[model samples]
Target: MAGTPIANSSTKCLPEGMPSIMGAIYPIEIMQDAKRLVVLAEFLSQTRRVHIGEKMPPADDTEPSYNGYSVARWDGDTLVIETSRVRPDVLFFNVPHSINMKITERLRRSSPTLLENKVMIEDPDYLSRPYSFTFQYKKTDYKIGEFVCENNQTKVDAEGKASLQLQPDTK
Candidate 1:
């Protein structure tokens, strides 16, 4: 299946942590200050913190991770962000990224109600060349709500069947 994780007994529909590419696909709320910019996803509740500029140095290669280290700079109306030192813990679809994975993104407001994100991901380990894509979001009056994953809350019964606990309605 194209763009889908490979089907395997050990493969999960989604990994424990947010995949690096999700930053561009999901609905994100961006909060910025003098020092850093925080992008918070409404779905998985993932948060990415990016340094304002080259002021913050990239993380040591020994500290590889999913999101890695992100640094951003403002180019007129566009915010250019570069991330590197990523680990292979998460996959881009079914393809795994190497520690050398690097991502560059351009975020800009297309309109008063529209946000656009152009992203490019590179990883020689799993990709023939860099892949680029763009994702956009239209402003909505909708509010973000709580999203809790029950994957870790699964329990096994005496019969050896796993089940999730259905939370009681608070309303």
Candidate 2:
């Protein structure tokens, strides 16, 4: 049987890495301080941190993770963030990438209430060249809500395909 598609990892309650996490339908909240900033997703309650103006450790010095290691600095009005050392298991958005993937994101306020993130993805092993996309978020008074993916009732067969578990009839 083929391995489970990375796109379905969320069905198994796994963290959906990087750009996919930031590009989700759910709203995200950002909290910042002098040293770092954090992004909090309303979906699955996932959190990501970026150390501002800090040096990123070599891949060998840090563990691979869904969000990887991120370092950032301010470029004029934009905050430039670069992430590397993501796990070989990358984005769950159907697009496949390799272990050498490096992601750069530029975030800025496009309007008084709108924030934009321009993302650039690079992976020579999986992509012919680098590619980019953008995600915009509107400032809202809405509170961030909690979501627990762990409660999903989907069942996976031995082959790694996922399906909804059918409840037995009580009639």
Candidate 3:
């Protein structure tokens, strides 16, 4: 459960939005197998995409509408995920990434009580080089509860219009 911090403590910027769902916690029962892991990640990724007002256009249309495409794999006890083809809809620390951006993540279960996640972001459109980050989570015996972001709504005024507040200076 060791790596770089996901966010800069000094800055209060929210990259995607105020209600941005970066990670989740699930019962050990749900993550018992690779198939389950893939299913859970896909489900969560889809949920996040839809939350950001991104849409899946008709297959016939050449233009892209979806924010990002993700694929997951397992490396020993670690789950490696690669995401690309982002639609420049959500901002990273209020800075947007282009459609060519790609992100890689590695999730490892360090112990029965802890899970470690490391994320690498590569976007030539916005960043000078690939930046990596890590996030740690503690396990709990509590059952998984219903988690929803849309239910709790909050608005912020940015550039004279109401918008979701994004975490600032996320690296």
Candidate 1 structure quality by residue, lDDT tens digits, 1-171: 244333321222232332443544545677788778887766456677788866535455337765677888999999888888766766565567777787888889999998888889887877898899887778787666655544444544454344554666779
User: What are the TM-scores, per candidate, against the unseen true structure?
Assistant: 0.71, 0.87, 0.56
TM-score of 1: 0.71
lDDT of 2 by residue, 77-112 (tens): 999999988888765466777778999999999999
- Could you give candidate 3's per-residue lDDT for residues 1-171 as a string of tens digits? 253233321122322321123444222222534332422222223332221112334334434333354556667777776666555665555466777677777878888888787888888877899988776777666554443343123343343233344556758
Q: 127, model 1: CA deviation in Å?
A: 2.5
Give the per-residue Cα lDDT of candidate 3 at 152.
20
Which window of ten consecutive residues has the lowest lDDT sum in model 3? Answer: 9-18
Better of 1 and 3 by lDDT: 1
Candidate 2 wrong stretches, greater than 4 Å: 1-7, 158-160, 167-171
Q: Which stretches of candidate 3 lie over 4 Å from their true place?
A: 1-20, 23-32, 36-67, 143-171
How far residue 150's Cα lies from its native spot in candidate 2, in Å, is 3.7
Q: Rate the local accuracy (lDDT) of all candidates.
A: 0.66, 0.83, 0.49
Could you tell me how far off, in angstroms, the CA of residue 144 lies in candidate 2 after the best superposition?
Answer: 1.6
